[model samples]
Target: MKLVLACTAVVLLLSAVELARPMRRRKNSIAQIYRAANITPVPEQILQVNFGGIKVTPGLEVAPEDAVDLPTIGFDFIPGCYYTFLAYNSNYSISFLSPSIVGLYVNLNGDMLADSSAIATWLGPSPSPGTGINRYILNVYKQSGLIDTTDEQLLSYQIDRLRFPIDDFVATYGLSGPVAGTFFLSQYPVFASEDCL
Candidate 1:
């Protein structure tokens, strides 16, 4: 009887140790992701971006240094997924920035562009006194191939820059537009957007 009790105790100890071991790695099952956002089944592709500590609500003001984690992507973000991300100030002198690490420019494939001979970075919104709530928008698009940057600042740094529309850029690759995007407004007074734009 005593021998039987000892054997039972050893079996229980082994079972506890196995239960505490780390689980095995597996493919990124996206069912949890869609459910977390309360959305429909995962599309052919989706880009998930989040600016931690940001509330997608009203009366919000954000600083430049606040960290923005790299956009979360699905398993579909393969080596072929050359994506371009742009940041815009609606009231600026009609310009856009393919924002990167330290305010430099890079193409959709994450390759650095010419004449932007600096580190890759993103310079957050530095709204002017009268800019009146700037809409700092970020749009990510799929690029079929490399697109060159024509200007040191962007395609054009002046009023003519307005012609470079993000939707059109996306459509050029036979894609509708950014699979996902999120925006936050800068307040000079109030804002026009209240959700992830």
Candidate 2:
């Protein structure tokens, strides 16, 4: 009778242990953003633009990823959304990066590298060598409509300014956009052989 009771006690203990099994809670905060619906409600990806403390010299092939804090996961963007990134070298009398005003890359897809509906490629910063601390004025504007965007670009071209061309670019284009971020990096003279591919 004592053996049967001991066996019953062991069974009960095993059942209790099984019932007390541990379960891990989920940690994905944005996982529940999507649900079963006609129009899938996708969460907006937050974009963070930053220059990774890289000193850019003359004729450097500085990719956009270098400007980004994290290259593996660069600027977060949404498809079908239009965005424009503009940069100006405040140290220079004229901007070699953006020869024209308000358009480093205009009407570009927020997610992709190229401007699908564009006539040219992205113009990067080309601060003249020996310049000290060129404050690159960077801005990102969300296009509300294509017509106004085109109008703004044309209006920006009409403005003729020797200094603070970025100001004219902003005012003419009605940029009124939030400055995504800014960087102050120097460009010094380096030998042709010193260039990095």
Candidate 3:
């Protein structure tokens, strides 16, 4: 009986370790992907991004059109504090390691239900042919206070929304705590581009 009990205990211990492996791998994978892309560090809170009637998890492959509409960003907001939702494409340029901004929307009143401020309108992923997987990151930044933006500036942003320096923008707006974020992968249809072949 003693030997049988000892074997059972060992089996349970091994089973617990096995179950924990995936969770640890998941955490590491999230960080690894974010770091690899050279985007801002991964936020502590992970936002749930639902696109095209499906949840867009990290590293999930998606077609460009599947992300034509804005994904539903799910996160718990802190009342009285402002937040900014920005989408970035880390592989937009043909040159290696070039990144650009795809969208920018600010929740001035700290409410997602109302019409939020859209500094730069949403432009879905349109990676050029032959460019491999492009990582589209949706970052939720908690602002220190109300952000000031002029109509002329907003118009200019729409005109030129590429090669955005994310760090500079964060400092300019006093943005803190990407409080939450999520990212997905998208690529152009290689088959459609015979020239790319």
Candidate 4:
């Protein structure tokens, strides 16, 4: 009986050792890489703003001839952070400048209804007004390949449902009083390969 108990203890110890071996190796490999590469974590930034009473700028192509000017009543976002905008009782639009690809998602009321990879193209020349805004909710992200502009089919998919989030955005922004009647977005180039106008 004593011999059997001793053998059982030894077996348990060996099993435990085997199970820990892989974890130990992984830890050591991670440590060696960290030391060799001298990696550092980047801090993230968040941006939020509230604009009241903005005007709509009319152009030959985009806005209506008699469109009224609007104000930005409520705005908040951190460029690199995961962010979402909600609006109510209003339409929303956004335009991306050179090199920055914009992925659009829209939720009607409180329900998510649409997501697209391409809302508009701003590659070669800037639009007539040089900026874009809509009276709607606009969610922005800074990840690559989130909006694919290379394929025609995919681009159509994005544009077709691009206006999904307008209502919720208007409500949220309008709660603070009447909004500027337009939600404007301005984007700049992140790389030399990208150019706007």
Best prediction by lDDT? 3
Residue ranges of candidate 3 with Cα displaced over 4 Å: 1-39, 108-114, 151-155, 191-197
By TM-score rank, best first, the candidates go 3, 2, 1, 4
Index of the highest-TM-score prediction: 3
CA lDDT, every prediction? 0.44, 0.42, 0.77, 0.31
User: How many clashing pairs does model 1 include?
Assistant: 8
What are the clash counts of all predictions, listed in order?
Answer: 8, 0, 0, 40
Residue lDDT tens for model 1, 147-191: 555544343433333344544544543443444333456644333
lDDT of 2 at 79: 64
* Candidate 1 accuracy as lDDT: 0.44
The clash tally of candidate 3 reads 0
- For candidate 1, report its TM-score: 0.43
Q: What are the models' TM-scores?
A: 0.43, 0.43, 0.75, 0.23
lDDT of 3 at 150: 69
Q: Which segments of candidate 1 are over 4 A away from where they belong?
A: 1-60, 64-76, 91-121, 148-164, 167-176, 188-197
In candidate 2, residue 59 scores what lDDT?
A: 24
Residue 98 C-alpha lDDT in model 3: 52
